[model samples]
Every structure is written in C-alpha cells, then in structure tokens.
Target: MVIYGVALLAFCMLVGIILGELLGRLIGIEANIGGIGIAMLLLIFLSNYLKKSFNLGEITERGIHFWSAIYIPIVVAMAAKQNVMGALDGGFIALLAGGIAVFLSFLLIPLLSKLGNK
Candidate 1:
C-alpha cells in the first residue's frame, strides 16, 4: 500500500535525526548534524531498494515520489535560511569561509565535468 512509502520515509527520518544528534554530540556541538540530508539519502536508497527487490507497487512508488518532490525542497529551503542566519551570527570569518566554499565548489564544477567525460 501507499502507506508503506510513508512508513519508510518516517523510518529514514527517524534514523537520520538520531544519527545526526549523535554526530553533533560526538563533535561537541549542540545541533543536529546533516540530519535532513541523511534522511533524504536514506529515503532515496531505501525507496529504490524496495522498488527493485520487493516490487513495491505503483501506488507506493507514486506516493514516495510525490512526497519527496514536495517535501525536500521545502525542508532544504528552511534549512538554508537557518544556515545563513547562523553563519551571519558567527561573524565575518564565517561569511568568508562560506564565500570561499562557494567559490571552490564553482571551480570544481568544470573539473568534475571533465572527469565525467573521461
């Protein structure tokens, strides 16, 4: 049933949040670390596994695809705003680091593209 898809997503989210919390604590931080990203990855992996191995029906597939399409962007947008606020609060060094990271990522795109071609 389509409900299974929801259950799988909830399970992934739970695992991700718990892992993120543990990781944050391990690193001496008081926040969840990469929880949402972990959850998204889990959902993607698990959903594909289910589809391939168990023959998860059309209904379940559609449900998972629909919610993922709708939910992830909203969650990511919220997280991005929080990150920006936190970075701003952290000071100029945080901003400089973010800017450098962005610049490096942009520089990597062409190199990555070339790697894909070869």
Candidate 2:
C-alpha cells in the first residue's frame, strides 16, 4: 500500500534521528549528525530491497516516488536551519574556507562528469 511506503519513510526517519542523536552525543556534539542522510539512505536501501525481494504495487512505488521527488526541497529546508550568518561572522577564515571548498567542488565537477561517463 502507498501508506506502507509512508510508514516506512517515517520509520526510517525516526531511526535515523535516534542514531544521529546517539552519534552526536558520542562525539560530544549537540546536533543531529547526518540524520537526514541516514534516513535517505535507509529509504533507498529498504525500497530497493523490498522491490527486489517482494512484489510492490504501483501505488506503493508512486508513494515512494512522491516523497523522493520532494526529498531535495526537504533537505534544503532542513539545511537552511543552520546559522550561515553566524558562520560568516565567525571570521574571514570561515568565508575563505567556504569559498575555497566551493571552488574546489566546482573544479571537480568536470572530472566527476568524466568519471561518470566511463
């Protein structure tokens, strides 16, 4: 059922949040570390495993797809909660490091694309 897919997503999200909290505590950080990433990975793996191991209906697939389609926006919204202005105010070093990281990431795009082509 489509609802089952949603239920699965909810389960993954809860587990991810718990794991992330645990990880953050373990590392002495007061944040949910990689919670969303973990949830997304869980969704992907579980969905794929279910698809292969059992026969999922079209409605269930559609439900998964629906959430997947909005996943980016959800992630963006979650990330937007971070204090970017505070980071910027921290120091020029933060700005410079961010700029360099962005530049390096941009520079890697071509190489990454070439690798993808192969």
Candidate 3:
C-alpha cells in the first residue's frame, strides 16, 4: 500500500513535469521551475482525491513532513551562500515587495473565496 502510494506520487510528478515542460516551451518560459510548480499543484489535487477515495487520513501531512525534511537542508544550504547576503542588499525593496504580496493576498484571498462561493 505504501509502495503503491509512492509510485502514484512519482507518476503524478512525472506527468506534471512533462505537462509543465510542454506548456512552458510553447510559451518560451523556463520549464524547470514551472514544471516543479505544476507538479506540486497537481500533486496537491491528486493527493486530496486519493486520500478521500482511499480513506488515507493524514497522508498529506506525512507527505508534507517528508518533503519538508528533504528540502530543509537544501534551502538552508542555499541561504548560507555568500551571494545570498549580497542579493539581500536590496533589503528595503525586498521588504516592500514582501509586504505588498502579503497585503494583496490578505485582501485577495477573502474576495476570491467569496467569489468562489458564488
């Protein structure tokens, strides 16, 4: 059962990667990151359906933890790079952009949710 879940996850990721690459290439965008984003979105939807259909409570939580554990070190290593500090020299702009993004999401999510309900 666990192996089946793993296999299904891998298959979904591969499909998402392929689809993202095709779409990105057609649009002249970078495929690797786009592929990952598409893969993640597809994985989320598929996981929800699989959990409901299979009664696999907390499967998503497990997957989240697993991925986080796998990626945390990679992220930390990237952040540790000397160039990362230099990149953050535009700290004020970064903060402003971050704040704007947060503010927009705060306003947008509720409005979007309401619209979705309609």
Backbone clashes per model, in order? 0, 0, 0
As a whole number from 0 to 100, the lDDT of residue 87 in candidate 3 is: 56
lDDT of 1 by residue, 59-86 (tens): 8777677886887789988887775666
TM-score per prediction, in order, is: 0.62, 0.65, 0.53
Model 3 Cα lDDT, one tens digit per residue, 1-118? 4445565667778988898888878888875546777777887887778777876545545655565577878888877875766657879998799789999989988888898595
**Can you tell me which runs of candidate 2 are displaced by over 4 Å?**
71-100, 108-118
Pairs that collide in candidate 1 are none
Candidate 3 clash pair list: none
Q: What residue pairs clash in candidate 2, if any at all?
A: none
lDDT of 1: 0.85
Greater-TM-score candidate between 1 and 3: 1
Kindly report which residue stretches of model 3 are placed more than 4 angstroms away from their true locations once superposed. Answer: 32-88
**Cα lDDT, model 2, residue 105:** 100
Query: Of the candidates shown, which would achieve the greatest TM-score relative to the real structure?
Result: 2
Model 1 regions more than 4 Å off: 71-104, 115-117
Q: What is the C-alpha RMSD of each candidate to the true structure, in Å?
A: 4.3, 4.1, 5.0
Looking at model 3, residue 100 earns an lDDT score of 97
**Distance (Å) between predicted and true CA of 113, model 1?**
4.0
